[model samples]
Each structure stands twice: as structure tokens, then as C-alpha cells.
Target: MKCIMDDLTVYTPSPPAGQNALVVFPQARECPELPPSGYAPLRGSAPLGRVMLRDGRSAWAVTGHALARELLSDPRLSRDRSHPGFLAPEEWSAEVGTHGASPALVADPGDEAPHRPPLPYLTPRRTAALRPHLQRIADRLLTGMERQGPPADLVSAFALPMSALAIGTLLGVPYEDHDFFEGCSGRLLRGRTVREAATARAELERYTGQLLDRKRHEPGDGLLDDLMRQDGQGSLDRARLVTLPGTLLARGHETTADLVALAAFTLLRHPEHLAVLRAGKTPMTAVAEELLRCLATPNGILRVAVEDVEIAGRTIRSGECVVFVTALINRDATVFAEPETLDWDRPAGHHLAFGSGVHECLGRNLVRAQLEIALGSLFTRFPGLRLAVPAEEIRSKPANPTSDGLLELPVAW
Candidate 1:
């Protein structure tokens, strides 16, 4: 697809900051190192640089706070992949793989016929049906944690297993199959190599298909079973159904697990906040809101533009990809006061943690519930929990392309 840039509007920066100030550019590669300071205004006066995507296409990446928000919510800027001139960055396409079978589903939003198939794992109706099972699984997780004792790696122990059980039970995946699914899901998320990600996805489809078939003959009260009953709701067909579990496996569990561990880690780092939560001074709802903001893993959200649009004085043309920097948005000085500081008592309000608009995360409510229960119970049960390793030594994928997470977070009571 050829993108016309002759008419694209150019942004001119005012001038340089102090000698030590970093230059901001439109090229994602040229993105300035984000400081630990929560609110770093965009170097607006700096010239917008061109990002040459791995695929050889170029697009403008605006770092200005106003520009980011305007571009994100603009109607002309779309998330759909079906636009006529739609293209994906080589790195992203290589990672997500080409959507051959479900071409329409992955097509640019500008495509004449966009497919919006209902996913069994994330639908509200399915979630409702799976609640009882989820509660039971939650109980099992808590019990297992109690029995195993602390001074453990929360990532592996409570977070991973609980996530595995919740997602597995919802999809009717057998406990014995956890490792296979988990491994596939992990590879799918982490594999930077095209071949590896594709292979993992293929395996995931095969596994989900097998599980769906099993649920057919012996239908249970699981989400998958409920989805099978919704024939006319553009419910996932066989091929899509098979791929659906993998999406759920990745989306349902990984981020939530990270959030759980990260939330606990954040609280431990901020004892006053932890005390506020435990003392019942702050409602669970308040804690949930704060946790959503504080515990978000750093990958941010990704979306592509379907049409040309002007935002905050910059023109974002159609067929370009925009990476909405949610982490930066949440900490914008204009939005949050003393953005650098973690204030549990800060007045709870709107946040983009679950995202905004039509594509907002479907499992957001469940995620919040799980976090509330997990954090509230854990901290209340083990008030003295603290890091077992040096804070700096704690291993994390700080610049992870897909997520913000710690490989191992050792904690002791």
C-alpha cells in the first residue's frame, strides 16, 4: 500500500531545552528515554522525526500529550485493520502474524466489511456463567497459597497458577493441559521471531480446537459451552473458536497476573497505601482504581489509523500505526497532580487502564474483582510481607515490547 505524504502537515518545534535536554522525534526509535519522573511533557518544540518501520513504511509518532489524546479518540483514526491501504509495522506483523483465515477479523477498520466476531472467553454472558467456577478456582488458589507458605515467588506461585486455573476453567481446559497451554501462550507473547510466534499460535489453535470438541459432546457450564449455544451472535466458528482460547490465554491471564504481582509489589513499596487498604479506610473500589493506575505493566496500548485526521495540530494520515502511550497518559501532569508520587488517598476518577471507548478491555470488571480479592486477602492475611531480594536486583522486563512484568519477585512475610 502506498501512503501519500506530500500533503502531510509538518510540526515545527520552538527551540532546544537546556544543553542536557533530549531531542524528541517522530521516529519511535528516536523516542527520548522516559525519565522516572511520572510527568514528562512532550518536547513539542522539537522537530517531528520520521519513523521508518521495519516493513519499510514511514509514519509520524507524536509525543505531545495533547496530540496523543486527540489522535487516540479521533473518529478518522481507526483501530480496524481492514482499511484499503492498511499495513502493519514489520516488527508487529512479524510478532502478531498474518491473519489469513480470519482476514476480515484482522482487516483495517476502514475495510468495507469488518468482522467483529464475539469471543467466548471475554463476553459478558460467558463471564456470568463462569463466575461460580471462577469463585471455586479462586478458593482453591487461596487454599494452595495458605498451604505452601510464603517466602515464595508470587509470579510462579499464586499469580501464574491462579491465572491458569481461572482461564483454564473458563475455557474447560483440563488441568493436565495447563503446562502446554501456558508454554504456548508465553511463547506467543514473548517470541520476537516470526517463526516461533507462528508455531506457538498454530499449537494454541490445535489445543483450543480439541478442548472445544470435548466440551461439545459433554457440555459443561463453562464459558466455551455457553458460547457454543449462541449460534446467531456472529459466534466464533470452528477455526475462530480454536484461535479464541489463545487470545484469552494471553489476554485473560498474563496481564492480570502481572497486575496482581505488581499491585502487591507497589503496595509493599508504599506501606502507607498498603495500610490504607488494609485498615478498611479506603473502600475496595478505591483500592481497585488506584491499583489499576499504579500496577499497570508498561507495554501500553497499540492502535492503527484508518483515515487521515488532525490532532493537536499534527496530521496523522491513514494506514499509519499509533502507539497510545497509556503509561505516559496516566501520569500526565495536566491530568494527575504530583504525578510522580504514589498517593493512595488521591481522589479516584477516570483512568485509561482498561482503555477507553469501544475496544476497552472486556474482562476489566473481572480483573478488578480478582485484584481486589487477591490483594485485600493477601495483605490482610500477611501484613508483614516484604521483598526478599534487593529492589534493584529484582529481575524485570523493563523494556518488554508486550508487557511490564517481573520474572521472579521473591517476597517474605
Candidate 2:
């Protein structure tokens, strides 16, 4: 199998004439926790090589740190899902592909909107302003946990709901409607079927669209209200004003919530690291950064080549898809000393946990703020917290597109 680039360019490049092809793709039903052993086979091969996906689609996979960053930052690559041959992982490819503009899909009908301005609400000063409120939320959740007693699944009780509430507060979404938004957003992010995903997306849009209109009459101090004002003043378009909030609402909760659960799980597995936090020797910021690097979710970032470009001795033709295996890239041995170990004191270097280039995540500051507050409060409050189940028994939910998160994380103090 081979990837077909734009204009029917079919290049059957050999594996260095004498080298065998590297089977770097993860096998079906393989455990996600166990990193793929593909690197061993690619030792003598190029950093970028062809790998057959689980669905038998062949595309290029970028694993090396240097090459990953180069390709990610390259303008020749495109994030527009409409572009043909843009290989999304099997699970999410269908949903994303259908949502693109070209085919008049209901989810994202018009052309992808021009990039919006950096969220005016997420300024450092604003985040600092919101820090106390965030802490109060964290404290309230922990208090509820204390009242409810132990053996609680942090994913549902703490991580999931807390994340939802934080984003809801920012978007001016009513607290009473969080359950509906959370359910729809979960399916939108991780639904098993395209129909499931599309339905969830539609429901979220309907709800947010209504909320956006409501704010016009009774405005509040939230991003939604701000964007609504811009739209009313004609600075923002209707399509963007309608869709942007939904994107923030879903993504804002999904990724951060997963990080909270995963960070907790990582600390539980590495008691020595947990001790660092428990002893209060290392700053929570440092610990959060280390965990972010180490447990960088195994979600693969997808891109399409917009124009022919030579990278790493290989030509990525316009229209071909590329998968930057960030989890692999973050753990590259050359860039990170002792990359496997969790060291809070390790000097920070560029990591693609949040991605790179012009399309880097917009919510990063908000994410960092939430992580620091959530993790800082959780450990500080419950010094005796430990997993209710054995580490090996913990199961990860399938990557909804690229997010790898826990189904439940049972913990007790």
C-alpha cells in the first residue's frame, strides 16, 4: 500500500534499496500503555517512513524530534481536514473528514473561518484574577470528595466535572446545563460512530447557539459575551461567533480533564515523584510541566502537505497526509536526557504536548492555570490519597481522535 499525493503522483520509494520496510504502526488490539516497539525496526531507516495504519491505509509517520518540529512548523503542511489524503487516525478520520467544508457537511458547512484573535479573556492578568476562583472550585470539589468518602473515581467526581465547571464559568454557560453539555461534548470528542459524533456536535451547536443569542439580551462577563459583542458590532462573523464557543466548550473541557486524570495517575504510579509533590520541595508548576512532558497524551497529530516539500531526504508531495507521533517525539532520547524517567528538575525544552506552529493550541495558558490549580489543590488537600485499584488494572479509554484518557480513576485518602 502507498499514499497517493496530489495530482496522482505515485512514488514507490524503496526502503534504502537493501533495508526492509519498518512496520511502525501499532497493531490492532495492542495495549496503548505499552509503547509500540516500532523504533527498534526503524533504527537504520529514515526518521520518516511509511507505516500501514490499523485500517490498512499507508501514510508517512514522523517520529524524530527534529523532523517532527520541522514538519509541524512548515507552512507547506495544512490542518484543513477537507484536503484529500489527509490521513486522520481510523477512529476519527471519518468524522473529521465529513466535517470539512468542501462537501457541504452539516457540522462545518462554510469554509474554515479565518483564525480568531488570541482570546482577550485569557490574559495573564485575567488568569491571575481567576486563580482564586479556580482554587475555590478545587477546594469545593475536594470538600465534596471528603464528604462523600473514599473509593471515588476522580475522573467523574473531580477531573471531569471540575473541568466542565471551569470552562462553563468562562463561557457563561449555566451550571444547571453542564450535564447536557458534558454528555454531548464527550460524544463529540470520543464517540464510536460518525452518527454519534455528528449528533453530539449538532446538539452542542444548538445549545451554544441558543446561549449566544440569550447573552445578547442579558450580557455577562465571559468569552461568549465578549465574542457576541464583537459579532454584534460586525467585527466577527456569524459562523465564527456561533461555532467558536462550541469548539471552546468541547475542547476546553475534554483535553484539560484528561490531563488532570492522567497527571494524577502518573503520580500514583511513580511514588517517588509523588513524594516530591507531597514533600512540597518542587513547585507544582515544575511538577505539572514534567507530567505534561512525560504523559503527553498518545494522540497523533495529523496534517496534509499543501505543496510539495523535501524534508529529511524525502519528498512530501502536496495532498499527502502526515502523522506526527508526538508521544514518540516527546520521548526522543537525543533531545531529552533520560527521557523515560520523570524528573521535575529537568530543564524545560520544547515539547509538542500542546503542538507547534501557527495552529498551536489557543487554550494553553488556561490549561496551565487549571493544571497548576487542580493538581496543587488535590495533593495538598489529600496527602494520603492513593489509587483504589492496582496500577495495572487501570484501563485507558480509546483515543477519541487523539486524546488518550482514563475511563475512571478510583482514588481514596
Candidate 3:
């Protein structure tokens, strides 16, 4: 099966001749706890190798930890798909080209936002400060689940709502409008076609523009208020001001939602490790770090080279694609001793679960706090919480470069 992405055609590309690529999503579902073994042959042969994309175009896959970091920081490679060579697929043209979002996508480091408005608001200190507030949100959601009883779909019951509420609260988006925004967000992920995505994008853009206007008159403590304050200083122009919330409000929450659900599932899969976590044998903070490293998104990041360059003993022509295997890099045996085993005792903070360089995840701090708190709250609230079905019965989203989250995680106490 092709990669499960927005309602578009999912393509699984095989390598041309000698090239190798992580070409399918079915492998990802075969084992939810690990990245596809297809990545193994590519990594085993070399740290960097040529790969094939859906278009039968070749890309460079960086599987090593150190090299992924070096290239991640290099400005020579760009996220701007308009570059002659970037060749961002047609589906992405609307998002990167039409949106012109300064902060980029959630997975995007958003390093390019020149004096981006949300930076001050997203710092680790500030996001960490939201912990108490976020905890209340998480507690409230978990309580709702308990009242409803078990056999609940954790993705809907706990993960999605928790993430949506937290991000909505952070950005000051009205909670009442979450249903509308959530529908728009899913469509944006992958529309039935480019047209559907474009429609979703347009609706979201309109909503954000209107929301900005509303916030201007009714100021609040959320990030949007601060962005308005920046706009007053002429720091943010009409385009950025109008789109910032839509950009943040959409990707910000969904990105964390996938991670939350994945981490919870990962723990339940490992009963012994879950026991250690429950007993506090290892720090929850450290456990969160390990989960990020071990189960980091496998799709990695894509960068287009503006100029021809050589790295890891290979030459990449300008416009060629560069893939960083975040999942594999975090599992590098050289950097991570026994990378396959999820060991919280080790120092795992340095892992590249989130892309690195200028585009490193802006939501990093908030996500960390959420993951730690969400997990802690989950087990504490329902000590007996466990999978409601056989492991194989669970469904994994078709693998996509952006996410491999479960369609729904059924849980019971």
C-alpha cells in the first residue's frame, strides 16, 4: 500500500537501479515500536545513500547521527520548495507556495521566519510555564474519559482533545471553534486531491484572518495577542499577521497529538518498561526523552540543495532531494548504545527525533512538557489502562514523510 497521507495518491517508489528508499507504509505498521526494516539495508550499506521518491526522482538519505546534524544546520540546503530543484510535489505546492507561512510547518524548524512573532511565546521557559495550565487540560480530559468509561478510543478521547485544547489555549484560539479547525487541519494534512487541500487551506486562511481581527479588539494573554502587539510595531506585515495563527493553530496541535498517542502505545507495548515507568525507577522526563529518540518520526526531513555540494563521500547536484532519517539517526548504534532498546537510563536528549539546524522544531518545549505530563497523567488516572485489542488489531496510518500515527488507539482499564 502507498503511504497514507492526506486524501491524495500515496506512492511507494522503488529505487532506480542502485538507489534505495524507504518506499512503503505497510512496513511501518508491521511493527509500531520501530522504524521499517527497509531502512536497515540502506543504513547497513552506508551512512548516506541515494534514494527514490514517488516521482522516480533520486534523493540522498542521511542515516548517520553526526551527518544528519551537520547538514541540518547547513543553509546551503533549503526548505523553500520553489527553488528550481526543490521539486516539492504538486500536493505541497499550495501549502508552501500559497500559504507563505513564515513559521513553516510544525515539523519544519521554522528557522526562516525573519523575526517570527511566535518565537518569544514558544521558548522553553514560556512553554514550560504553561505546564500547570496544560496539566489541568490533560486532567480534565482524562476525567471525562473515566466518566465515560473504558474501551475508549484514546486518540479521540484523550490525545486529540488534549493536544487541540493545549495548543488552542496557547494560541488563544477559541475552543468553541475547534471542531471546524480540526476538520480543516486534517484536510490540510492531505486533501482528497490538491483541490480539496486548497479548499481547506483557503478556509483556514479565512478563519485565521477573521480570528486576527477579533483578537485585535479583544486582547488576551495568548500568543495571538503578542503577535498583534508585534504587528502594531510594523514587525509583522498583513500576510504574516493573517496567517500566523492558522499555521500555528493547525500543525502545532496535531503534531503533538500524534506523538502523544505514539508514545502511549510504545509504553504499553513494553510491559516491563511500563512497570519501570510506573514505579518511577526512571525519571518521567528521561522516559519522555527516550520515547522521542526511540520512536522519532521515521519520514525525516526534506531539504533541497541550492548549489551542488559533496558530503559523506557523495556528490549531490543542486535541486536534488536530501532525506534525513530521524528515526534511524536516533537509533544509530554508534551514538546510541543498543539503539533498538528503549533505555531511559541513558542520556537521550541529544537525539534528532525532531529535525535539527535552523528549522529545529519550534514546538519542542511545549511538546516535551505535554508528552511528560500527558503520560504521567494517563497512567496515574487509570492505573489499569492497557490496550483493548490485540496489538495486531491496531491500525497504523499509511506511512508518510510527516507522520506514522495510529488511526485510533483503543484503550481500557
Candidate 4:
């Protein structure tokens, strides 16, 4: 296929002679150590280019920093999955794309269904109010890790459990229910088949719906209760309330868990960064932002063009799908000097790691708090922390190209 670049025509490779050729979406199967491919080649091309989805669907891949932010913020680009030609993740079936909201391992505001009430408690003030409680949660999790000693899988021992506990408490879900929710959420978010994901989603909604009913009569001291209070005050409907918690439970734990594990892995690989944290030379929060930029793992988010729109000198016809390759945009050389290098001391500006514009990550403050406390308390307790296995040997969940997670980050002190 031909792409117009600055009024010059460029041809993307087509199939060989007789057989149909597929423009395969870039996979990191070979470069497991780095971000996905396809992106590097597009660096010299137009801001928006083409890539074929696994389902044999063609979509635009937005890779430039400026264009990515522009398209993300543009209201003409709809995140509503119901739109015709909406692209679901490669793992999902076409039937899944035709359904309601797509399964998201990482939630963004744009994905919120129209019926759902706004998550007011995710505001900065509310996150700040929950700080002391989160501190206790982080400290307690780290304490358990310290007691267990090293040669432990951080994903299971520290990352997943800590994220589950913190988000579970905030949502008023019983801590005991976390194990079950975690299992279901994994299937919903990471399952390879649509049937598997749908089954997990149905089970999760049923559970959360039951909990929502109980909270209606017996209010608790968490966000769920707050939502229930809003429903009672005629601000939110019960049906929307029922569906909202499922989104929270599905997204809240998984992404943060991955962040914690990935951050730890990155630090272990760069002992000099770990040394800075031990020396307390820089604020953990600043260090956290730098690490977030380096470890930010969102692959790309699907958006459908609602109306004909021109972006980066290319016109996108209405109803066509476009994916903003966030991982590649976050590493744009124009924004981050030496974009590939991890520089804890580098003065970085607002990054798309949490996304941009109105659809920015609602849990940004909460995630920052979790990372700050989790990384600080963790390294403080284990000054001798080091990876138990070589970096190359560490495996990742290959089901998703965006995943920055290790299947198990084994560490020893």
C-alpha cells in the first residue's frame, strides 16, 4: 500500500507475487529485551503509518510524539468500542470488538461506559486523604517480604499482593476475595480467547454486583460506599454503579502490580540507580517518575475516527481505526533526551506514560503514591537486593506486546 508523506508517495511493501501478503504488526518476540518492533522503522516515516492487525484488519499506527498527543486529545477520535471498525486488541476476536467496552489491562478515562458514574474519589484530594492508609499497606507488604527473606518472586510476593491489598481496600472489596478476583481479572485482561475473557468478565460483574447490593444496605468506608452514597443521593444509578466496580477491580490491581515488578527489575539491572535510592540522594517520587517513563509499558490504545480528520498531514476517513503507539511515543527522542537511557536525575516533563488530555489515567496519583512508598520501603529494607536470575533468562507474558511484566522476577538479597 502507498502512504503519502509530505506530498511524496511512499510504498509500504505488499505481498510477494501470487499469495496474499500481510503487513504484520510489530512483535517483540526476538527483541524481548526491548520494546516492540514496527516502531523503529516508522521513526523516519510519516507520523501516522499502517500496520495489519492479527485479525487481518488494517489500522493506522500513530508513532510521533506530537501527533500522538494531538490525536489522543481530539474529540473526533472516539474510544467508544461500539463504533464501526473499532479495533480490539490482537488477542480478542472480532466478535469482542463488536460488543461493549473492550477488555483493558490498563484503564483510561475514555473507556468508561456512558452509563457509569464518574469516579470522583480518584481525584488528587481523595488520593491524598488515603495516603496514610496506603502507607500502612505498603509497609505491611514490605514487612512480609523482609520476613520471608530473598530468592523470592517479587511479582507474587510483593507486587501483586501489595497492589491487590491497596486497591481492594480502597474499593471496599474484602481482602479475602482478592485471590479470586485476581484469578478472574487475569483471565479477563490477559486471556488469549474472547470466550475466556467474556466468561471472566461475566463472573467478575456478578461478584461485584452482589457486593454492590450489600453495600447499599450496609455502607462501608471505601470508594464503593461513596458510589453507593451517590446513588442514594440520585447522582448515580444502581445499574451503572453495579458495572463500575468491575472496571475498577479489573484494572486497579493488574497494571500497578506490573509497574512495581517492572520498576524493581529495571533498578536491579541498573545497580547504580539502586545505589542512588539507597543513598537517598534524590526524592523517591522524582525517581519514580523517571522509572515510570523508562518502564511505561502501554503498547497502544484503540480509537476510531468518528469524523473525517486530518492528522500529521494524513487524512483519516471516519470509522477507520487508529492506534496511538504510546510505548513508542513515550520514547520519542524529541521529548526525552537519550530516550532509551534511564536517567534518574534527568529533568523530565509531563509524559504520556499515564496518557494525556481528558482521558488521562485516573489513578495517576494513587499509582505514584504506590510506587514511591513501595520502591522506597522495599530497597530500604533490602539494601542487598539483586536479581536471582540473569536478566535475559527472565520471561514475560507474551500474550500482549504491551506487557512490561516478568512472569516471575526472582530476587535474592
Best by TM-score: 3
lDDT of 3 by residue, 128-215 (tens): 7788889988898898899999899998888877876677677777767867766676666445555665577678779878888888
Q: Residues 62-86, candidate 4: write the lDDT tens digits.
A: 8778888888899998878666577
Model 1: how far is 28 from its true place, Å?
Answer: 14
- What lDDT tens digits, residue by residue, belong to model 1 across residues 1-413? 11111111232333344423332311221111122221132323312223333344554544334555555566676655434444432343332333211212222232122334354356665656656666566566666666887778878777766665677766667767866866776566555455666688788888777787787788776566767767436645676566666556556666777778777776776677777777788787678776676444534455567767665456667677666545555555566676556666776456567666666676776676677767776776677788888666665533333445566678888
Stretches of candidate 2 exceeding 4 Å from the true structure: 1-34, 37-46, 88-121, 175-180, 187-200
Model 2, residue 354: C-alpha shift (Å) = 0.9
Clashes of each: 12, 0, 4, 0
TM-score of 2: 0.82
What overall lDDT goes with each candidate model? 0.57, 0.68, 0.72, 0.69
Weakest 10 consecutive residues of candidate 4 by summed lDDT: 1-10
Arrange candidates by lDDT, highest first: which order? 3, 4, 2, 1
Error of 3 at 148 (Å): 2.3
Root-mean-square deviation (CA) per prediction: 8.4, 7.3, 5.9, 5.9
* Candidate 4 Cα misplacement greater than 4 A, ranges: 1-23, 29-33, 90-110, 174-210, 213-218, 399-402
Model 4 TM: 0.83
- Cα deviation at 237, candidate 2, in Å, is 2.9
